[model samples]
Target: MSRFYEIDPTPENYWRAIILFGRNTASYKFALAKALLELHGNGKSQVKLEELAVPYAKHLAQHIKQQPKQITSKRSSFLEQITAYNQGQLDHDGLIQQTTRLGFNNVIDAFHKVHGNDVGSRFFIDQRRSHGGIELTDNLNHLLEQLSAEDLAGEVEARWRLVEEAWANNLSRQLMLVEYEEHDQQLIGIHSQRRISLTSARPALNGYQKGRCFYCYREISILYGSDTPADVDHFFPHKLKRCDDGKPIDGVANLVLACTDCNRGAQGKFDQIPALPLLERLHTRNEYLISSHHPLRETLIAQTGASREKRQDYLQDAYNCATVFTGSWQKWQPRAEGVAVF
Candidate 1:
């Protein structure tokens, strides 16, 4: 019966067979790998997989059931021979023959004869990410219960050990890619029109009234559908350009929460800088940009054709341009009539 499949029918490990007979489509590849990981994590039980695995999972249920038992014999079915095979009981060729002698070579012949190395490499990456804790998590164990279990022996066991050691290397998924942090509050409040929109003069609206394009204010979804008020902005972006390997800059030093309209309109009109969706979420409540900070303002000035002194002048300019001629400051605002240099 074991001859019908390889010792490691782990569809995960059998690439050649998969490539020869199966169309290696992306969806197929991902689905298979995901299924394999799900199975391994669940301790290989089909009865538990009804919901996520659906009908196909049910079909594989029996095959998964019988396979594990065969490999995990209750009384160590081929005990003495397994002992000899495990303890360097034979030469390399002899070990190969040991399978024939034990009448189990058929289970592995497919593995030895598959398509290419792609399957092996992918399976290896997956294995590296499924460590003890990653697989043993509450959600994961429940997930595992749905798939059939495998006897964690031989190559599987050895590979698992190596994976555990290299577990930290697998961080992309573990590092949950979220646009905003939990502390990020969506700012979507209707402020009274009387609020001095720094074009109304505080440090806020100086950029546009002074000639630089005022960037768009952002309105990020706090809980997925909330909008925020517009904050002041500088459409021409400025910041420390990140290195090729560096992550997106999320520090307060890097972002200025702007109003939604401003953000949408700014759309990389100037230098390439990422938008701060977090602050935008909070903007629905208030039109505050990094409106209260110094660095964001300083960076903005620096990005303009400002010399260091000019940048410093604005950063500490006791008389903010927006506040200069209160009438002009109050009246000067960003109009689309400006040049569309973008």
Candidate 2:
């Protein structure tokens, strides 16, 4: 398996990597994702740019209503056209016409690039030169075999929301600090005295881990409808929260998604200090979070350390403290062997 799909080499993982790990210069990738899922549902293999523009522009328009700034760039004509359409300044036909001409400049070529590398699988073929739009590939159809269209689409939306919310909140200023709520297992954005519930910790964090349990690397779901939704686990056991001089154990750096069997089953690592190797994985995961654009990057930097070496020492110190409290053990092993997806 390639590094991108190391958890399980499936069509679904490839698709998830595209949505989860692709760089978001603008939210157009997400708009294209929403359009692809909608078009796929209608059973169209070949779609013209005009047909693609309708859903693509519509998704952008909807998002502009919620959050005006969709791109990191200072200005975007395509987004402005959508904003105009929402304001009744541009008609539907005008919006679609402009979208077909301006909206798909880069997303079609960049969709499959994950972490600066193109994934081995292709979800759509860009036929804009001769065919006018795109040709949905069999890989996309096989993805439906692995996961339902609704769930896959929800993952895209969740990731889009997470990034846009962080963008809107200006990362450098620390406008809002993200905090974990243990009672509900939700991440809250604190601004001054007001507390806003950002999103459920599962969907926000699931994509970075590539839809697998952090320990076992088994396939997991953030969908509430799934038979076994993964658990939002504390990487260091929650019981060790008091040992770190009151440093919050529930921060994004210390929380990971885990399968129920590995989290609380008979052979679970509940309240136990995980083997030392897992601490290195936690460090890697946190660095990945820092590399991403989400406010969780700021939260992790604040909770752990600003630099990589400091963060490494932070985890090392925490592990030493936890080992003193709860005796160290290397007995726990994941139910399956899987490579690191990140």
Taken over the whole model, the C-alpha lDDT of each candidate is 0.27, 0.81
Tell me, by TM-score, which candidate is best: 2
How many pairs of residues collide in each model? 47, 0
Number of the top candidate by lDDT?
A: 2
* TM-score, model 2 to reference: 0.83
Scored against the true structure, residue 333 in model 1 reaches a CA lDDT of: 29
Model 1 C-alpha lDDT per residue in residues 262-309, reported as the tens digit of each score: 445453222333233322322211122222222222223323214544
| Model 2 lDDT tens row, 46-73 | 9999999998998889888998989999
Task: List RMSD in Å for every model shown.
Answer: 23.8, 3.4
Residue runs of model 1 more than 4 Å from their true location after superposition = 1-224, 227-255, 258-302, 305-309, 315-319, 327-342
Displacement of residue 210 (Cα, Å) in model 2 is 3.2
Estimate candidate 1's alpha-carbon lDDT, on a 0 to 1 scale. Answer: 0.27
